[model samples]
Structure formats: structure tokens, C-alpha cells
Target chain A: MSYRAKVPKPTVKRLSLYLRELEHRVEQKQPTISSRQLGDALGLTDAQVRKDLAYFGQFGHPGIGYDVTNLVDRLRKILGTDRTWNTALIGAGNLGRALMAYGGWQQRGFDIVAVFDQNPDLVGQWLENHRIRPMSDLAMLVKERDIRLAMIAVPADRAQEVADRLIAAGVRGILNFAPRRLDVHQAVSISSVDLALSLEQLAFQVSLGLLGSLDEDDD
Target chain B: MSYRAKVPKPTVKRLSLYLRELEHRVEQKQPTISSRQLGDALGLTDAQVRKDLAYFGQFGHPGIGYDVTNLVDRLRKILGTDRTWNTALIGAGNLGRALMAYGGWQQRGFDIVAVFDQNPDLVGQWLENHRIRPMSDLAMLVKERDIRLAMIAVPADRAQEVADRLIAAGVRGILNFAPRRLDVHQAVSISSVDLALSLEQLAFQVSLGLLGSLDEDDD
Candidate 1:
């Protein structure tokens, strides 16, 4: 289990990109792909691609390169995407509704089993198939669905409180979209999808004329 | 401008956090703050805070630390958020709609001047006062509004095509929400916000029971 600690964060991120590329290759009926080809497609070096893959296990075929389908499966298991994860979503606002309508997560094996909102008017509203429940129902649903992962799309002011509730309800992983930072216990895992931060980073790069020359990390 | 090349990517990201923290500090009427206080709030070390701030200039006083408002202004200028950036949003789907409705970007200096979707039915529809334009109007709008940045929230298959159109329309930077990797020109900068990828990363950590012990990078 400590193996994940050994894998660098950037490597973990690149693994997701590699998995996406391999899946694309599979769709194109590409039986195999060389490290150079794989790396080139993702704007990475062949050595980096090889090294990242080698971290998990030895899968290189010496001359022929890696089997695209096999690598896809292995990467899936390594990233823990091979199985379905029942996830809870906090907030029923515009962003939360959009996330519910977003089919990408379900396709990637993360299913939003329940949605919660503090607004009384939105409590019974139906987003996709799940009825938007109030905050009080969060604990019940988390336990009922065995939900360990949660997504927070609440406003910045309410995000921390929502996170605390999710953690109290036994959620171990959180993907936060709010712009505020949350203080969590050491036993929890949280990743943020900060839209403004991403835009700011892009703005910095464009402002300084630092374009694609650098080896950018694609998180 | 070349100083950005010397500033590590992580440092650049940290700068954004520093700005956010400083802005928060300003609102709280805190005139000055030590590097340790700022770093503690952000889960970084005082040494890291000092080093990152030192990269741009000597903002710290020998005893008084840094002036909160002054540091915020400097960080804003350094990150290029001091001025407003007129941006375009391609694809008015669910996720795209969410971004359009999200007000965080505007507060951070990114203004979505135009919204575009290739769908004929949605072409004349309005999203937050800006009518959805077809791809044909992209070039004109880019010139008219001085848009150098764009956000692509289109389907994975259409992401590259939208990016190409944006680049052709003179977009120098892109924040892509698509799961696919885009091939942009060397002079253009691109950042991706992959929701599924973030969930996958969280899943991996939760699966390994690697909760919060590791020094997680907050991107």
C-alpha cells in the first residue's frame, strides 16, 4: 500500500494521461505502440514514458514496444479505476448539476450515488436520476451506499463546512471544486479542481510568453 | 520574462496560493504577515515561502515580514492577474455552462467575453447574456475583443478541433476540460482540467490507504 507513496505525484498524473492515450490507441486498433510513439503523442520524452511505466512493472517488449490493450488494463488497475467507486456529491447548485449531467465520471468508473444540498428548495429536486437530498441525509446515504469518495462543488464560504461533514460521514477521498482550501485530518485524501487557478496559471504563461517550450506537467 | 523559466512550475502554482492567502489576509485587515504564518496557512514551510517570494524580489522585511496588501499586489502583477483577460469559452454543453455560470474566474481577472458552440440549435441561445456564437464568428470575436485565452469544454473527440480553431483565431493560451491530449503550436500554452483524472488519482490514494501522510501537491 505504501507503493503509492513511492510514486511521484507527477508520475501518477502521467499514468492517467498514458492510460487515456492507450485507450485511444485501442480504439484505433493499434495493437502495439513504441515508447517513442506513445511519448510523442503526449508531448513527453520516450525515456520519461519508459521510466514511468517501469515504475509499476516491466512491460516493455524490447524491440516491438508495449501492447496497447494490456497497458491500458494494467494502468487501470494501478490507478484503481478497474472497479467502480460509489461517490457522493455535495451542493446542488449550477456546478453540481453540471457534474451530475457530466457522463465522463461514470464512464471512468466513478459513480455519483447521491447528491446533497443544504438549500431546502433544492432538497427534493432531481438531478439526473438521483434526488437531491438535504445535508442531514448525507451520513445515511454514505453509509448506505458505502461511499468513500465525495465531490464538493459548494460555494467557497461553505466548502470547508461541507468537507467537514463529508469527512464526518466517513468519506475518505474528496475532489473539491470550491476555491477555498479545506483543513482535513491526516487520514483523508483531497484533490482540488480549481478553475480560477488553472486560468491564472495559463495567464501567467501567456503573459510571460512561456509557451510550449517547457516540459509542462499535464495535471 | 525569462525569470518565469527559472521559477519552477510548483513555485508558480504556489504563487497563486500565496496571492489567494494574501488577499484573504488583506480582507482580514492584517497589515503584515511573517513567512511562517503564510506558509502555515498553506501547508508549506517558511523556508519555501521565503524562497518563492524571494524569486521575484525581496518582499520580506528583516523584522516586519511582508506587507499583506503590497505582497498581494505584487503577486497579482507577477501572475498577470492585475489586468483583465478577455477569454472565450468553446462548447456550451453541461460543463461549459457551469464554467460560464461560475463567477470565480471573473474575480480572478479572466472575463469570458464570448461563448461558442458548433451546434446549430444552440448558436443563437444565450448563456449569461452572451449569445452562443458559431465557430465562424470566432476569428472576428478574437480580434474584436482582444481574446488571447480560451477554454475548451467540448467532447474529447472535438477538443482538438476546437483548440485548433481557437489557435487559428489567435488564442495564445487554452484551459482545456477535455480528457484528450491536444496538439497545439509551440507558441501556445495549454492547461487541462480533467475531472475523471482527478477522481482516478484520489481513488488510487484511497485504495492504497495512503491518506494524508504524504506531502500532497495541491494543484
Candidate 2:
């Protein structure tokens, strides 16, 4: 139901940011927005905003600027967030439990329908609404639930092995929370969320008295 | 002592990646690496690598390239990861507990020395080495520990309030794990790690059959 375009990765990330801003405007009952206003709010130039949006398709009006509601719909579809996606979470540790209870995913059309862990003690225990299943059931549950996306919260040493298993079990996209760079097949997609790396960046900026004035659109 | 530089934010992020790759090479007893080799490992161009490194100082040799061990040390210093940073974690929930147990922080010179929560029942609870303290103790403990960095793992609704309190408590940098975008003064540095946004990006790429070929150096 979705199509791919040859958009730059940075542009793709900015699309999400624009969506957030547009959604906020929608909540405020705003009907139209100029690229300059949108870019100013996000610390980006109006030309940059126009070019990034142009990569997908034309959504801007000459004088009316962009129709806020129309652009929001197109962005949601382009980001593949318009439909619900069933996702799997591996690792029943604190990170996994926290992710299970995270309220943001359901609001964004992602539902973590299954949880898997290697520990025998954690297996069969219920976290939120789903039970913590063992690794052996990963393939079966993935197929049963039609899960194409998975999240890895395992430790550094176990992340690679768990990723291998997820790929073999038919999970196509992975959101890795472990502080490790995963090597996956070129056909699959992976995004890493390194918590400590984020803190380190903050430390570097703080040490230099950087204000982080511009909210960089990044993962 | 650590000093700040006017380095671009993207370069700052890539410096961390270079440090990781260099440290790995050091462990393997590799003496030196060319810009091409280092950039290849991190999915960056050789010129890009050289430019990023050049922002701090000259470290590359004509033929011998960059000294692995020395570059690692220099990058660690430049990124403010050479010395331990005392940090406080606000929120003793599942996310905070997982962050407490994360092994990557210590290796990278960040130590989460304090844990705080607003819930009275969770207060005084022991998580790892630190007991959960009430919010009333936040300012005093931050002063007593000389803590300038903090991690906000609180829920989205409470993130802004917690950030205000932390900034008032003399924290200079914040690594926010909450999904909300916080408004803070220009003096303090803040970085957000939105887990659901990472998932949404992955879903977008997966839906479009994008390979995620390039490991973009982003937060």
C-alpha cells in the first residue's frame, strides 16, 4: 500500500519532523502553513523544507502555502505510519518491559503484539497484555502475528545473535536499542537508538557551552 | 580538563563513531588506519572523515595515516568521554532501571550516580547501586554530587516539568528519553532519544523496501 522514493536519508528524517509540526498545527485548528513558518519553527530554511517535501511530491501552493491537513495526510502515508504494524520485542529485561508499557507506539500505529526472551524465568510471564515467550517460539509467533518489524533490547553480547534470529525468523525491519552496531542483510532495515551515545553528545556540547539551539532532525 | 569547540553537531556525532571504530582496531592491535579504511568501516567517505577529524586538530600522517590508539584518546577527549561524568536519572520506572543496568555508560565514561522518582511508594527503593530518591532531594543531591548531567526517563507529560526542575538544580545537559519535545533555556543542552520515532522511521523504510544501506551518523 506504500511506495518508495529515492529520498535522501536526511530528508526522510525531516519528513517525520514536519509531520510532528503539522500535527501540532492541526491540534491548534490551523488550516494552512507557509514553508517559512514551518521551517522557522524547526530551525530549518524554507528552501530546505520545500526541497525535502518535493522529494515525495508537490504539496505546496504558490500563495496559499501548504494545506496543513492535506500535507499531514500525505506525510502519514509516505512515512508508512497511516496503518497499524504489528511488532515484536526481544529481551524481557527492564528495557523490554518499559517498551511494552510505552504509550507512544499505539498512538503511532505500531503494536508490540509479542515479547520474546532467552531466559526461562521470564518466559510465560505476562508483560502488559502479551506474555514473554521464549526464543523457540519467535518464528512461530512472528508468522502467526504477521510481524515484519522487531525491536532488540538484549545486552551488547547477545544483540548480534538475536538480530540473526530475528532476520531468519522473517522480521524485515529492526529498531535496535542495544548499544551495538548490528550487521544485517542488505535487504533488511535497521535503526539504532544508543542511549549512552546521546548522553555523550550532550556532554560534548555542554563542555563546549553549546546551546543545541537547532533541534537537529535525527534518529 | 575538557574544552569545547565550534565543531558541527554532525561531526561531533561522527567523532563518537570514529572513536568506537578506532577502539575496536586498537583491541585488534592494529597500529594505524587510513582515512579510507576508517570511513569505510563507518559508512562515511574518506574526505568526510578527514574533514570531521580536522575540525579538532591535525592527527593524520601523510602515508602512515592516523595512529589508532592516539586518535582514540584524542577523540575521547574531544567528545568529553575521556573523564567520568556524574549523571542523575529522573524516574525509577522500567526505562530508568534498564538505563541503570546498561553496561555501555561506564565504558564510555558516563556514570549514573543518582536515581529519582516522584512516586512515594517507589522512593527509597534500591535500583542497582543507587536508591530511588524523592524529587525534593534532586537539587540538594545534584549540588552535593556536583552533577551537571541528567537523564529524564519520566513519562511524556512530566518531562517538561522534570526538565525545568533539573535545569534549576544546576544540571547543564539533559539526555531525554521521554517522547515529548521539551522547551528549555538556551544555556542547557538537551538531546532526545525517542524510541517510537525510531520505530516509525524503520517502518517507513521497510514499507518502501528501502535497504537502509548507509549507516548515517545521526543521533
The lDDT of each candidate is 0.82, 0.83
Q: Model 1: per-residue lDDT, tens digit, A1-219?
A: 457556666676677678878998999999999999998987778888898898788468989999888888877776778889999989888788777776788788888899999999999989889898999988989999999899999888999899888888899899888887677866598778888888888888777666763335532
TM-score of each: 0.81, 0.92
Tell me the deviation in Å of residue A203 in model 1. Answer: 0.5
Candidate 2 residues lying further than 4 Å off, grouped into runs, are: A1-5, A213-219, B1-5, B59-64, B213-215
- Among residues 3 or more apart in sequence or in different chains, the pairs in candidate 1 whose N, CA or C atoms overlap within 3 Å are none
| Native A-B contact fraction in model 1 | 0.60
Per-residue CA lDDT of model 2 for A152-207, tens digit only, reads 99998999999999989988899888888888867588888888878887888886
Q: Which ten-residue region of model 2 chain A has the weakest summed lDDT?
A: A210-219
**Candidate 1 wrongly placed segments (more than 4 Å):** A2-15, A18-78, A120-125, A213-215, B2-5, B25-38, B45-73, B213-219
User: Model 1, B1-219: lDDT tens per residue?
Assistant: 557456666676677778878898999999999999988888778888898898888568878999998888877777788899999999898888888877877778888899999999999999989999999999999999999899998888999888888888888899888877687867598877777777887887786566662224533
